[model samples]
Target chain A: MAFIQFLKPKNALEEGGRTAAPIQQDAGEPEKTCPNCHKPIPLSRLWSSYLVCPCGYHFRMNARQRITMIADKGSFLELFAGIVSDNPLQFPGYTEKLETVQNISGEAEAVVCGTAEIGGRKCCLFVMDPGFMMGSMGSAVGEKITALFEYAMQKRLPVVGFTVSGGARMQEGLLSLMQMAKTSAAVKRHSDAGLLYIAVFTDPATGGVTASFAMEADILLAEPGATIGFAGARVIEQTTKKALPKEFQKAEFVLQHGFVDTLAPRSTQKQLLTRLLNAH
Target chain B: MNQIPYAVVKLARDSQRPTGLDYIQNIFADFIELHGDRRYADDPAIVGGLARLQDRYVTVIAMEKGHTAKQRSCRNFGAPHPEGYRKALRLMKQAEKFGRPVICFVDTSGASCGIGAEERGQGQAIAENLMELSTLCVPVISILIGEGGSGGALALAVADRVWMLSNAVYSVISPEGCASILWKDSKKAEEAAACLKLTAGDALRLGIIERILPETELGEKPFYDRIRRALAEELEALEKDPDLVPKRYDRFRRIGQVKERT
Candidate 1:
C-alpha cells in the first residue's frame, strides 16, 4: 500500500484519466478595446478605426508612429540610437530581462529621441514607449531625454516630449529617481535658452515622468482619454478615503479640473501641433 | 485648486487709483510690478509686483499660471520653469536688499520641465532659491494656493509662516507616481496617496505648515476674494509683529528631528 501511495500522482485525476485544462472556456476570443472610447470593440473594428475610436478617442502612439502621422513619409532622422542601457546594479535576472525586452522591443530604452520634421517644420521628438516594460524611465531613458533637450537647444528647435510611463523604473532604483533631477535640470537649461517646449501626454503618463518635465511644458496638451497626472487615481482615493469620480485619471477629467492645456483628438493632433508651433 | 487675491487688489485699486480704473484693472496704483532677472529675459510666469498691503509696502511674488490657452503657454502653466525660478530669486534678493518683507504665493505643480530649463540648471536654480530663502534676513511668508509639488514648493516654502488652503496639495511627487513605483501598479495610486500624507491637514498636523485658513461661507464669493483675505491676514499679522521672524526661524529649525542610539 505504501509503494502504491508513493507511485500515486499528486492529483487524483493525474493518476486516473483527467488531464490539465485551460482556465477559461473562451480562450479563442481576446478583448480588443477602441482607443478612443475605451470600449471593448472587436479587433476587426479596432483596425478599421485607424487606431482611434469612433468617438474620436486616441490610442497611445509611440514616437515613430507619431512622427509618421505628423511628418512627411519617413521624414524622421533617428538620433542617439547608439546609446544603450547597461546593468549597473546587476540585479538578479535583470540583465537577461533587459536583453530580452530590448530584443523584443527593438529599442534599448523607452524613448526614441531625435530631430524630426513634421509637416516640413523641424522639431525634436522624444516619444515614450508604453509597450517597453510599461515605459519605465531608467538611466538610458534619462540620457536620451537630456540628449533631445540638448539637441533642441543647439538647433533652436522646439521640443515635443510625447510621454507615457509607469513612473520611475524600479530596476534602476536611485538612478531612476536621479533622472527626475537630471531631466528637470535639462529642462531648465532649455528654458533658459528661451526655446519652446511642448509636452504631449499620451495614455497613462503618470509617476516621476509627470512630476518632472512633463508637467513643466510651456504647452501641455493631452490626447483624448489619455491619463495625465502625477498621482494615480487609486493613490488619491486610498489616501483621501474617498471614491474618485468615474473620469478620475482620464485626460478629459484632468482638462476639466485644470491639469492640462487642451485635449486634442487624434485626427487633429498633427494639425494642432503645427498650429501651436506657429503660435509659439 | 487655489484662489487668487483679486479682492485685496480690487480694494486697493478703488481706494488708491488716483484718476480712474478699478483696483483689479489698475493694480499698479496699489502695487507696482517689477520684471527681469537682469541676467536674462523676464519670466512672465512669476509676477513680482511691489504692493501696499495693509498700508505697509511689500514685495509680493506670485507664481502665475495662465488662465487661457495663450496664457498657459506664456506662463508655462505656472511651473516657474528654470528662468522663472531664477527671476524669482532675483526678486527675492532685491526684496531682501530693500528690507521689504517677502510674501510668496506658491501655486505651481512644480518647476518647469523643459530642455531649456534643464540647460539653465533647474536644480541649481531651485537649490539656490531654497538656500536664499532659508537665510533671508527679513521676514518671509509663503502660502500654498494650488499644487505645491516637490522642490519648487519647498524653494518658496521655507519661510516665517507657511500656510495652505483646504483643497491644496503639497508633496514630493504626485500620489499616483508614488504608487506605481511602490506597488508595481499605477491603478493602486489611491494606496500611495494615503501613504504620502500630503494634504493640508496632514501638513498642518506635522507642523510643516503654520496654519490652515478655512474658505469663507460666502457660498457665492469669488475664489480670488478668499485668496486675498487669507493672504492679507497673514501678511498684516507678520508685518505688525516683526519678532515673528526669529520665532518663525526657530519654528522651522525644530522640524524633522531624529533620536540616535548610543
Candidate 2:
C-alpha cells in the first residue's frame, strides 16, 4: 500500500495541496508559451500540471515522462531495452541519424515496453517517445511490442499503450512497412485470447501506426487536440485541393467520426484507464 | 538482369503495364465483379468479386489502375479509399464463410489521402483488414503486381504467401516521398530508391516476399498463364495445410528478426 503514494492525485488536495498556487507567472522565471491560449506559463507550473496548460492544451510528453505519469512508482520493469535498430538495408545517413537521435533522446529505440502497475492493477505497458525520431515504428519497435503482447497473453494481463508516431521509419524501407503486419498479427493473437488492450493516442499518431496497432485496440482513447489520422494533413490538402475543415484530424474530430472511444484529457487519463482496467 | 531500383519503380508504375483488372481477367475464369462496401458508396479503385481459378472457386480482389485516363480517374489511379478496403474485407469475410481461398492483387501508390477518406476512417479500415486477414480461416495469397505502397498495399497483403512481380516495387513510402522528407529535395528520388531496397529481389532477400514471378513476356498471355499456374499450385499446397493461420502469423513474425545489440 506504500506505493499508493506515487499514484496520481484524484483531487486538488491530493495534488501536493498545491491547487491554490497562483496561476500568474513571476517575472524572470523560465516559461513556455501555450499554443492554445497564447499565454506564457512558468516551467515549474507546467511541470506541476503534468505539462498541461490551464487552457486545457496538452503539450507533448516523452515516453519516460509518460511512464512516470501513468505507472505506479517503482513498478515499471523495463523489457527489451537491448533491442535496438540496425540499418539492415545500410540506408545512407540512417546510421548517423539513429546514433544522433539515440544520444539526444537517451532512448535505445522509439518505443519503451515493460510491465507495470496502474492504480494497483497489473498490466503490460508501452509508451512511444516523441523525442526519438518522432516515435517511428521500425523493426526494433515492432519486435518489442510484439514480444510484450505475447508476454501479456501468456500472463493473462491487460495491455496499455500510448502511441505517438510519424508512422513506419522510412529509413528501414519495406521492412518498416512489414512491422505493421507483424504487430497487428501479435495484437490479433492477444485479442483472440480475450485479453484487454487499450490504446491511447498522443499527438500525431499517423501513417503506418494509425493504420495498424493504434486503431486495433479494444478501447481507443486520445488526448485532447491530438492529431490522429492515416495521412498527413498537408498531403491530404494537396491531394484534394480543398481547404481542411476546422480542427481536422484532431482527437475531437476522430471521436465525432466514431473512430476513438473517448477523449481523455491529461488530468483524468490515469483514473479513466484504471477504472477501465478494473472493469474488465 | 539487375535493373536499377528506380527503373523497377518506373516499370511498376508504368501506365501501360497491366493492372489489377487485367490480371483478374486473364488469370481467372467465370469472374463476377462484386460492388460496394455496403457501409458506403462503392469505390472503383478496388474491384473485388468471386471467380474460378481453373475448376475451383476463389474470391479475387485487386487495386485496379485503369489503363486509360478515363479509367484511371474512375479507379482513382488505384489508390483505394476507406470504402474500398471495407469492400475488400467484406469479400474476404464472404470467402471465409464459403471456405474459398482469397487472392489479392495489390498495386497502389498508397491509400487515398483526402478529406472524405479520413472522415470515413482510412486508418481504421486498414487496421481492421490487417487484423482480420491475419486470422482469416481461408488461405490468402497476395501478389504484388506493381506498386505496393505502405499500409494501403499492406491492407490486402497479410497472406499465407506473398509474391511479387520481378519488376514490382514495394516500399513504406515512394522514393520521391522519401527523398522529399529525408533530403528535403524530391530530386534525390533515384538515390532514395537505391537506399530503400524496394526491388523485388531486395524483398526476396529480406524474406518479405516468398517468390518473385519473372516478367518474361510481361503482360502477355504467357506471363498471365505462368502466374495462374503458380497460384493454382500454391493454393493446392496451402489448402492442404492445417496450420495455415499460425504459419501465416509466423511468416510475418519472423520478418525483421534481429539479434539484441547488447
Candidate 3:
C-alpha cells in the first residue's frame, strides 16, 4: 500500500523541461536528431520524456527507469543479482565487452529480474535493459529470466515483463541464442499454471527475444512508436524488394495488425497496468 | 568456409530434394502422425508424432512442404502456422514427459508470415518451441534436410546435436531475403548467398552444425543411409552420456567462436 507513493507526478516528467532547453551536440558526434522527423531533440528533454521525442519517435529507455515508472515505491526486491556471464565460448573480446557494459549500465547482465507490486497486486517484474548490449539475451540474462518465471509460478503471482532487446547476444554465440528457448519454456510453465503474463514491449525489440517470451504474453502492451519485429526492416525490405508501409514494425502497426493488445504510453503505463492487474 | 554461391542455393532448393517426410519414412519404424496443437485447428505444414527409431522410442517432428502444387498449398509450402509450431511443442513436451528422445527434421522455407499466423501468435509459438526444447531432459536431435530459413528453422534447430544434409542451408534469413534487404534487388541473391555462408560445409566449419551427411547423388537410399548412420552414432553417444542435459546445454553453448582481430 505504501508503494503507491512512489508514483509522484514530478518524477515521471520534468517540470516544463521540454520547451526550456535547446539541442546540444556531443563532441565527435552528429546533433541528436529524432530519426522520425529529423528534428534536433535536446538530450535533457529526451531523458525527461523517457526518450520519446516531440515527433512521437520512441527512443530506448533503460531498465531502471522503466521499473521506476511501473513498479510501486520501494516494492522491488531484486532476485538473481548474482548471475553473471562466464563467456562460455571464450569468444574474442566478449569478456572485455561484458565488463565494460556492466560498469556502464550498473547491471550484471542485460535483464533485471525481481518481485514488485503493481496496483497492490504482487507480481514478478523483469525488464530488459537496452543499454546493456541492446538488452541481448545471453546465458546470465536467460538464467535470470527463467528464474523469475519459475519463481512467479511458485509464488502464484502474475508476471509482467518489459522487453527491449537487439536479440540474442551473438558474442555468446549459440548459447546466447538458447536463452530464447529457455526463457520461452519458462513462460510456458507459467502459463500452464493459469497465471497472467503481460509483456510491455519497448523500442527496438527484435531477434530471438521478439521470437520468445516477448510475444507469449497474455496481454501485450507497447509504447508508442516502439520497434517490434523478428527481422530487421532493412532485411525484410531487401528480401522482398518492396516498399514496406510507413507504420511497418512500429508499435501502432503491431497493434493495428493484431500482434499487440493495446498501445500504452510510458507516462500512463503504470495506471493502465494497475487497472489491468486489478481487473485480473 | 565462405559465402555460398547462387548455384548452391538453387541446388539446395531443388524440387527433387528429399523432404522431411521422406527422411522420417526412411528412418523410423511404426510412425504415427499426430494432429492439431489442441489450442487450434491442425496445421498441415508440420507433421510430428511418436515413432520407433532403431531400439528407442522418440518423437519425430518434420516440416513438410508437400510435393505437388495442391499438396504444397495444403502444407503452406512448408511454412508452418502458429498451430503447426504449437503442435510440435505439444508433441515435444509429451516426448520429454515420457522420457523419450526428440528428433526434428527441418525443411521449411520459413514459418508462415501470413496475417492469420501473426494474429494467432506465430512468434510466440516458435519462441515456445525454442524455450521448451532447450532444456528438455531427454535427448534432442535436429537435422536440416533442406532450407532452414530464419527463426522458423531455428524454432526446431536448438537441439543437443544439429546436423545438416549436404545440400541443406541454414541462415538468419534467406539469400533472396538478405539480397532484397541488403541490396534492394532480389536478383542479387547470388551475391547474398555468398555472404550468408549458409551451406552445410560453411555451417560445419563455423560450428553452427555438428556434422554434415554427405550427398550420395546416387539416389534416395544412399542419402538415407548416410543420415541413418550419422544419427545412430550421435544418438548412441548422447544417450550414453550420464550428464546428458548439461552436456547438451554445453554443446550449444560453444557455437559461434570468432578470432580476435589483432
Candidate 4:
C-alpha cells in the first residue's frame, strides 16, 4: 500500500511554504472589494474589522487567521496536525490538486482542529479554511473532527467549531460524503456527555457540512451575511422556477427562518464566543 | 439484473410497490407505535415504535407513504417533515439507551420541501439524525424499500448494514428535480435517472448499500421472509461483534475509497 508522504505532519507544511501564516491573498488586492456595496476598501480597514467590510459584507478568512483572531495570544495548541488525506480513491489528479491547494493556502488540511483559550475559557476548536479545496470534508478532515470531539468528551471541555465549506470533496466520492455522518456522530457522542457544542457558520457553509455538525450545535451562530443552506441558490431556483428573495441563503435570512440562533458580525465573534464558552 | 437504472427508479416510485407499513406488519411482531419528538408535533410520515423482530426486541422506524388519498395527505406522501426526523432520532436514541437494535424502513422520495418544514430546521433535524445514528452503540439496520432521496433518506440510512430491495432507487436528488436543475428541463428526468446511478445495483456497486435483496415473482410473502432472514443473520452477527461502534464507524469510512480501479 503506497501512502502519500503528505500525510506526515512536517512534510505537509514544508511542501506548503508557511503554515503559521494564513492565506491573505485577498487582502493583497490593491482595493479590497466588498461584495455587498461593490466598493474597494483599504486593506487595513478590512483586517481591523476582521475582514467584514464597513458596508457589512463578510470577507473570508483562513483557518489559522481565524484562530489567531479568536484565540488568545499563544494559547492555541494544534492537534491532529499530521493526519492529511491519502487520495484513497486514487482519483485522477487528486493528489496533485491537494498538493497545489496545500502549497497555495499554506494549510495542512482544510480544517484545523485543536485546543484554544477564549477569554481564559479552555475549549476545543475546529476552524475550516475555505482556501483549501473549499474546506471540503474527506477522510482526513473527518478523522480530525472525530478525534477532536472524542478529545473534548474525554477532557470534559466545551467545543467551538467554525464551519466554512463548499461541501463534501467530490474527488473522494462517497468517502467525502460519509464524513457528514461520521462527524455528526462524534458531535452526538459529545453532546450525550452533556458537554456544550457551539457551531459558528461563516460564509458559504453549505452542502454536507451544513447538514451535519454545522447544524448540530447546542447554540448555533453565524456571521451576518454568511451563505448557509442545504442546496445552492441556483439549484433551488431552477428546481422551483421561482425567483428567490434577495437575501435567500444569507445568515440573516436563515436566522429569520429560525435555523440559526443569532447572526453576529465577524468583528464581535471572538467576544461573543468568549461569552458563550464561558457561560456554557 | 440487466434492467436500466430508470426502470428501477420508476419501479421504486410505483405506488403498487409494498410500502414500509406493509413490510413491518409482515416481518415483525407485537408492534407498538410511538410518536412525537417532544419538541414538536408528531409527524405522521415517520412511524416508529418498539417491536419484536423474531426473538430480538428492536426499535422499528418506517417512512409511510400511505395507501389512500386521505392517508397520503396524512403521511405527506412519505415526505417527512423535520418533526418526523426528530421523532425518528428520539426513538433511535431511546433504542440506543436500552441497548436494542434499530431497524428502519426507508421509503421517502425526499424530505418535505415545504416552507413550514424549512422554518422548523428541516436540514438540522435530518443532520441530527445522521450524526446521532452513527454513534448509537447498538446495531442499526436500514432497508431501502422504495425511493431513498437525498439527506432525508440518509438520515435513516446510516446504519451498520444498509439493505435495498432490487427495485429501490436512492439518489442525491429526484430525477425530475435533478433534470430541471441541471438541464433546465424536467422532461429530461429519464436522462437524469440514467446518469444518477440510483438503482439498488448501482448503490451496491458504489459501496453505498450493502446488499440488494432479490425480488421474487411469487408475490410479497417470500420477499418479506427473505428480508427477515437477512435481518436475522445481520442482527445475530452484530450481536457477536464487540466493537459495534467503531465497526459501524469504519463501515461508512471505507465507503467511496476504492483502492484499485476496475
Candidate 5:
C-alpha cells in the first residue's frame, strides 16, 4: 500500500486543479516556514533580516548566530569554551546523550558566555542555545554563567544575556537544580556591585532558568511572542484540567502582567540594547 | 539505613508527614502569624511570621501542606502561588531589616503550575527570592522538611545554611516527570528515582546540602527538639560571623563547581 501511494502521480491536483508548489530546495539555501505567519521565507532573506520573518515572526537562533547578530564584528571573544557537563550523577545514558548533543550542536554546553562589544560598548554576554538540549541548565551551564557574572563584577562590566531554555537539566538531577541558586547568587553579587544586567528572553524560557538569572536582570527585555514562564503550559493545563488562554505565557501576556519591561523585536533589538547600554 | 529511592520519595511526600506549621508550632515560641505579600493577597500555602527561637526573636516562613484533606485542599496542596513566594520574600526582607535571623521550612511539591500563577508572575516572584535571599543581611537557614521540588523549593532554600531531613528528596524534576520525559513512560519513575540521586544522602555526598537530620523519632518531640537546638546553635555561630553574606555567596558558589575539561 505504501509503495502504491509512493508511485502516485507527482502532479496530483486539488479541487481547483491547482498543483501544490514543490518546496524550493536550492542547495545550501533552503526556505524556512515561519510559525507565526505560516509563510515560507528564503533562508538567506531570513538571515539578512536577523531571522525575523517579514510578518514579524522571530525565528529561534543558535547562540553563535545570536552573538554574531548582537555583538560588534570581531569583538566577541568567547570564554569558558572548555566547560562542559560531566555525568555527575552518572545518570543512565546521560554521558552518551551529552556526547551526542555536543557533536550535533558544536557547543560544549547549553550556554555560550563571553565578553563582547555592543555598538562600541563593552559588556559581558551569554546566549543560551536551544539546539543544545533546549539550553537546559546543567552543572556546567550554571558554573559558566556564575563565572561570567563574577568576571563581569571584577571587570565592572554590564552583562547582557539572551536566554532560551527548557529549564534545569533533569539528567543531572539535584545538581542541575543547584545551578539556579548558584547563578542567581553570582548575579546578586554583580548586581550588588552596582553594575547593570539586561536579560533578553528569546523563544522559550521556562522552568529553572526562568526562576533564576533569566528574571534577575536590572532591565528585563523579551523577544516578541516568546514563551516566558516558570511552569510549562501543558503541565499547567493537565494540572488545572482547564483550557488555557490563547496568549498564555506569551511575551505580550507577560508584559501585560507587568513582568517584562518591554518586548524588543529582533530587527531593532541591537539598537535598543545599544541605547540601553549607553544610558546605563 | 538504605532505602529504595522511590520509597524515600514516597516517604518524603507522605501526607501523614508533619507539615510546616507543625515545625513552627513545635520548634518556636510566641508565634505571631504575619499575613500578606503587601502587594497581593496572602497565600495560605506559605505561612510566615515572627517567632521566638529560644532567646532570640526570628522570622519563620514555611510551605504548609496541611495534614487533613480539607486543609491540603485549602493550602493548594502546598503548591505555592506567586504571592506565596512574594510573601516569603517580604518576610525575609523584614527579618533583614530587624537584624533577625530568618528560618524557612520548605515542603512543596513545586510552585503552582496554573494559569493564575503564570498571570501573576510566578517566575518573577521566585527569581526575586533567589536574588534577595542570596545577599540578605541576616543569617538564613532553610530546612527541607519534606519534598524539595525544583525552583519553588529553591526560592526558599537559598540560605546561609540549607539542611534536609534524611528522607526528603530533592531534584530538578519529579521522578514521574523525568521518567515520562526520558523514557516516555511515567510508570518507570522507580528507575528515574534511582538515576536522579535525589535522596538526602546523595545530596550530602554531592555537597548540595550542609547536613541531613535523621528522622529517628519521625516528627516526635525529640525530632523537633533536635532541630531547635541545631537552629539555636547554628544561629548563634552564624550571628557572630561578620562575613555572613560573602560566606553564603561562597556556599552556593562552590555547589556544582566543575573544572574546565581541557
Candidate 6:
C-alpha cells in the first residue's frame, strides 16, 4: 500500500514499462527489414503478401484478413460491427488505446462476429483482431460475441470462430476477465443447441481465449506456424524452470500434443473447410 | 449420475459397471439395448435402449457412468468416446426412421480429449452428431443428469425439450481451467464460476434451455423420481402437440446469434 498511485484513469502500468504504451511504438510491424535478409524490401510488398516479408519474417494476420481468406468468395456479412467499449474501468490510457486501435482497424472491438459461408457451407464467424489492442476480450467483445451466438442459433447455422489474443485486456481490468466467462457460457448454449462450432486457432492464440471457446470447437483447427497454448511458453518455462520442446508453442506442436484437431495452411484453407463441412 | 442398471431399471450410486446395467432393467421392462455406430466399434460408455416408459415405448440413450476406476478409465469418466457419439447419432437416426421419440441423458465433462479419442476423430464425431441431431424428425428431449460439459453434452442436447437438474453445471470448460488461464491463478475459480453464467438459472435466462426440473434441497442427493416425472410430462406433451416435434430443428439453429443495430 506504499504510494501505489492507482492511476485513476491509467492502468497501473508498472513504472518499469510492462505497461503497453506511453510513446506508443509505431506498430514496428510494417517498416522493418527482414532481419534474415541483408536487403530491405518495401513494407507495402511485405504487407501485401500477408506480412511474410520477402525473406520470410512472419507477421501476424488480424482476424479480418483471416475471414476474407477462409470464407466462401465474397461471403462475409459482418455482424455486431458497431458495438464499442466505454472504458468503464477507466484504466490509465485505456480510452486512448481503444480509440487508436479502433480508428486503425475500423472495428469496434477485437472480434468481428457474424454469419458467413465457407465454400457454400454456412457458419457463424468470430474473427479476433490482434491489431485491435492485441485482440483482448473486454465487455464489448463479449456482448458482441454473445449476440453473434444468439444470431447463429436463430439462423440455425454452424459456428466458426478464429481466436488470436494476448489474453484479457489489462486496461479493462476485471471487466475484461468477466468476458471470458460470458463468452464461454454463450459457447455452452451453442453446444446445448447442438450446433457445430469450428474454432480456428491463428498465430498466438493464447491466454483466456485458448481456455474458452478456442478449445471448445467441435473441431479445433489451427493455422500453420500459429502459436497456441494456455500460459505463454516463456512464462511456463520460467515458472516450471524447465526447457520446453523446440516446437512447444507452435501450431504444429499443439497438433502433436492433441490440443488441435488439424493444421490448415492459408492456401488450401477454403478447400479444407468445404471438405470438412461435406464430411460433417 | 451414478451407474445405471438399464436391465433391471434401478438406480444406485455405488456398484459394479455391468451390474449397474441391471438396475436399469428393473425400472424398464422389456429393455433392449441398441448398440454400434454401424461405422465402427461399439461404445460401451454410451448405451441406448428401447424401453417402456409406462405404456409408451421410448428410446433412451444414457451415458453409462463407470463405478470402478477401471471402468471410469475406459469410459473416460462417463465421457463418451468418439464411438460413443457415433453410436448415439446412429440410434437417433434409427429412432427417426422408426418414428419413435428420443430421450438423451447427458452426464459427462465434454467429449473425450485423450489421444485415442482424438485419433478416432473425436471432434468430427461430435460434429457429425450435431448435424444429424439437428435434422432428425423425431421428438428429442434432453436431461442433464450430471456434468453436461462442452461437446459431450452437445452431442445429444439438440431436442424439442431441454431440461437440467438443479445441481448440474455446464460450460465450454471448467471454472478452474478458465481462472488459471485468465488470471494465471487457479484460486480464482469461484470468481470465474460467477462470471461464467453457467448455472441453470443463467441458461434459463438465455433461452438456451427450456425446463428446470426440481431437485431435493441439498440437491446432491439423487432424485431419480424427479427425472422420470419431468421427462414423463415432456414426452406426454410432445405426443399430443403437433408442433412439438419441429423443436429439434429449431433448437439446433437457435444457438449463437450476434447482430448490431445499424
Per-candidate Cα lDDT values, in order, are 0.61, 0.89, 0.74, 0.78, 0.87, 0.62
Prediction 5 global C-alpha lDDT: 0.87
Of the candidates numbered 1 and 6, which has the greater TM-score value?
6
List ranges where model 1 is wrong by over 4 Å.
A1-48, B1-262
lDDT at position A111, candidate 5: 93
Look at candidate 3 and give me any clashing residue pairs: A181-B130, A181-B131, A238-B180, A238-B181, A239-B177, A239-B180, A239-B181, B3-B194
Query: What is the lDDT for B99 in model 6?
Result: 82
lDDT of 2 at B257: 46
**What is the C-alpha DockQ of each candidate?**
0.03, 0.56, 0.21, 0.26, 0.54, 0.05
Give me the TM-scores for chain A across all models, comma-separated: 0.82, 0.90, 0.85, 0.88, 0.90, 0.80
Task: Output the lDDT of residue B215, model 5.
Answer: 93
Of 5 and 6, the candidate ahead on DockQ is: 5
TM-scores of the candidates in the order shown: 0.51, 0.94, 0.69, 0.79, 0.94, 0.61
Rank by TM-score, highest first. 2, 5, 4, 3, 6, 1
| Position A197, candidate 1: lDDT | 91
Pick out the ten consecutive residues of candidate 1 chain A with the lowest summed lDDT: A1-10
Q: Which is the winner by DockQ between candidate 1 and candidate 3?
A: 3
The list of candidate 3 runs beyond 4 A from truth reads A1-22, A25-57, A90-96, A103-106, B1-17, B28-61, B64-103, B108-122, B131-141, B146-150, B157-262
Q: Using lDDT as the measure, what is the rank order of every candidate, best first?
A: 2, 5, 4, 3, 6, 1
**DockQ, cand. 4:** 0.26
What is candidate 5's lDDT per residue for A108-165, written digit by digit as tens?
8889999999999999999998778878888899999999999999999999999988
Off by over 4 Å in 6: A1-45, A53-58, A65-80, A83-106, A109-223, A226-280, B1-27, B217-226, B244-246, B249-262
CA-only RMSD, every prediction: 17.1, 6.3, 8.2, 6.9, 6.3, 10.0
Model 4 per-residue lDDT tens digits across residues A165-256? 76666455445656778788788889989999999998777767887888999999998878887766665565457777888778988998
- Model 4's interface RMSD: 7.3
